[model samples]
Target: EWLETLPQDQLKCLVDEVGKSGKATRTVKLPTGDEEECTFLPEHVTNEKKKEKQTTTTFMPGVVEPSFGIDRILFATLEHAYYARPKDTTSEDKQTRGVLAFSPNIAPYKMTILPQDQRITRDEKYVDMMRKIRQRVSALGHSCTVDDSNATLGKRYARNDELGIPFACTVDFDSLSDNCVTLRERDTMVQIRLSVDEVSTLLHDLCWGRQKWDAVLKKYGQSSQ
Candidate 1:
């Protein structure tokens, strides 16, 4: 009866093999749900006495096995996030740049703090302001980093862009006076001016998808880069 559970072609093959060998070994489930290998003999080949001595078994039904490939998922995510920006002919440097355009939720760092110029990066006031901003952002449960290198502002932005940082806050000399910083978005390269306290809250809303960039642009207007 268990042999009848197999498909037609498989049953025919099994019958051919069993006809020659007089018996075939198969794994079957017992009444207690345990499985064991048992020798099966054809009905015609076994007498009534042999059939009475044999035990009954059942075959398991087909099942679906789900699998997850981590490596493939990572590769696909990288491919989706990666793209090359065209070279800027207007600038002195005309080299194409690679950028990882990961979403705010998926990016390793939600935002990066940048100094407008190398000079301000060394200033005590700018450093203190940057430190405070970083703290505020961290308090909101978002990951952030500061770039105080001597590299130009454009180079620093490009570096963070490659790192897939979704937002940037630039502290310039004016920030020392007004306590406001320039907030820049990665994908659209849009800049907006906002106060230090406002920036932290805005970054939180943006990262959490509570606010949209277009709505922000309409409210504050875009700042000149």
Candidate 2:
């Protein structure tokens, strides 16, 4: 390759000198089935074309070396991150609620919509409003699910929490009148009453990580961090 990229005279001269001094020996089998060595006698002029390529590579200009061993780097990183701590069996543990703290975008449902009363469940107005909310979330590539069961609000919230749903929207008696729903954050256990039109997009942005907790707090006039 180097000789191919070099000038004619430079390549030819380098070849001539190497052929005179460099003895190229290759493996050969002996008469007794043991191995012996042999090599073709190097001819300077006969191999002129190959010589140019070699010369260019040997004297590459403005070159920089990029080197690495991928396996070695991976091994080193693993060695540094591994921890060795002894477990204590006698310690007492408190109730953790077993929550997976993920950003909203990764949640299966950004928010759980809860109808306050059993009669409100599957009511045309509530169903149509939820469909609108789902459509809005779907358009933005977010997710939502309708839980139209006769379960209590607390039970509904618990079930969604098990599903790792990050937010809950409660359609209370107030919502039927004021067109607003109660938004509950799964992690912080915080609630903010928001209009049905406003909560869908707000939860979408929150889960997508485009908006932070501070921003949500600011929007709802809640405390920061």
Candidate 3:
């Protein structure tokens, strides 16, 4: 009885292919506890004469969901960017320096400004300069941060590399006297000095791919890791 009351159109749709082959079996158990064999044939398929007059036609095709796994993509990206290097210390314990070599567009922050010493950052004058530099980068719609943490300058640079920061600018006592700062490439650990006024513009261009690090090396002397 339950099967008899079921929507015939939907049930027929389910077995349309089976009807064409005539090789499928369907068992129906009635409410009275008796079993019966049933053949499902949609009106369109069962009656050859009705095809010319049928108003509604449907196509059965499989569809797939299109949402790609973003988390997996991110994981793969980080894995590809993973880098390791030798330790700076003499103990011979392999100091694995892990770095994320993310493209500028994908990085969390475009650049990081660090004072060579946290002690310099404590001075009001250097703090103000760092603030202005940050403001300049922010005005260009690029994100940047200041790491005034107590970690050694080398350690801070290493930490930012792991986080995939593309560039780092260091403020030292010479920046106060010469109005310039040292810029370091995260992956290469190459250093170049540029005037504070021109640094932000250069950084914006570099991050946007308008300028390349090779140009900096050509213009300024190089420093190694």
Best lDDT goes to which candidate? 1
TM-score of 1: 0.68
List candidate 3 stretches off by more than 4 Å: 1-64, 88-93, 223-225
| Model 1: lDDT of residue 223 | 95
Candidate 3 C-alpha lDDT tens digits along 48-78: 3243655887999988866778888998998
The TM-score measured for candidate 2 stands at 0.53
Give the range of the ten consecutive residues with the poorest summed lDDT in model 2: 79-88
Which sections of candidate 1 miss by over 4 Å? Answer: 1-67, 90-92
Q: How far does residue 51 in candidate 2 sit from its true spot (Å)?
A: 37
Per-residue alpha-carbon lDDT of model 1 for 120-214, expressed as tens digits?
A: 96788889889999999999999999988988898899999999999999998889788899999998999999889898899989988999999
> What's the lDDT for all of these models?
0.86, 0.66, 0.83
Pick out the ten consecutive residues of candidate 1 with the lowest summed lDDT: 44-53
User: Comparing 2 and 3 by lDDT, which wins?
Assistant: 3
Superposed on all Cα atoms, the candidates' RMSDs to the truth, in angstroms, are 14.0, 14.0, 12.2
Q: After TM-score superposition, what is the CA distance of residue 55 in candidate 1 from its true location, in Å?
A: 18
Residue-pair clashes per prediction, in order, are: 0, 11, 0
> Which rank order by TM-score, best down to worst?
1, 3, 2
Q: In model 2, which runs have C-alpha deviations exceeding 4 angstroms?
A: 1-96, 221-225
